[model samples]
Target chain A: MPYIKVQITRENVTSEQKLQIIQGATDLMVNILNKDPEATFVVIEEVDTDNWGVAGEQVTTLRKRQAEAKKLAEANKPK
Target chain B: MPYIKVQITRENVTSEQKLQIIQGATDLMVNILNKDPEATFVVIEEVDTDNWGVAGEQVTTLRKRQAEAKKLAEANKPK
Candidate 1:
């Protein structure tokens, strides 16, 4: 049995999108490892930004910082 | 940075239980790998019985079969 788990930052995902993720993961396991689809499990988890931090910063703050840095870089670029 | 995802068959888990899982995973990663608690991510997913299967049987069906088998074995056992 093969178990595949995907972790995503909290966001509203459409049911169709979830289906795609499930099918895609299952296909990869079956094709690459020759695992039986019936025995393969795919679980997707949507994590809160605060609970899913990186580099000691919450994702919400990290994205804000990234955006600000990008704006500054664009302003400093020569024409 | 360490990411831990827990997949459980769908059940009504209390908020406290979820917190335990999150904290436990984060603690393990930090203690074992020296990962920063702020940089570690833990997500728990409750999978539907239909979506989680084994040996070509869905979890719902598998559980039912297991219960039946246990009952039969108990009945057949000599006193």
Candidate 2:
């Protein structure tokens, strides 16, 4: 069985988007690996930013820093 | 970097349990695969039964059928 787990930050992802992800992953497995669609499983996981870590820092912290940097750059831009 | 994903049906899993799973998975990768714990990522995914399927049937449907069968068997048990 070709099982695919797609993980993304917990944003407001719609049900339609989840459906598309499941369908696309299943299609990829069937087309490339010659797997049966019935046997392929695709699970979409939405993780909270607080729980997802990158470079030893939580995504929540990283995203906040990015937002601040962007705001600073916009303020420095010539009007 | 080693990334491990653990998927389970949504069944009231607690925060402590999730932490344990993350630690256990990271330990496994470090002990067996010689991977650095700092570089290991463990993500726990809780999926609704409606989204999980087996044998072309949703887990929700299968679990209902199982519960019904169990109830029937218990009722028919010899006294």
- Name the fnat for model 1: 0.23
TM-score per model (chain B): 0.78, 0.86
Candidates 1 onward: DockQ, in order: 0.15, 0.17
DockQ of 1: 0.15
Clashing pairs in 1: none
* Cα-lDDT of candidate 1: 0.79
Q: Model 1 in CAPRI terms: which quality? A: incorrect
Instruction: Give the TM-score comparing model 2 with the true structure, all chains together.
Output: 0.55
On lDDT, the leading prediction is: 2
**Total clashes for model 2:** 0
Error of 1 at A45 (Å): 9.4
lDDT of each: 0.79, 0.82
In candidate 1, what are the lDDT values of residues B1-79, reduced to their tens digit?
A: 9988787888688899999999999999988899999999998878766555443345666788889999999999999
Best by TM-score: 2
TM-score of each: 0.51, 0.55
lDDT of 2 by residue, A1-79 (tens): 9877778998787766666677777878878988898888777678999999999999999999999999999999999
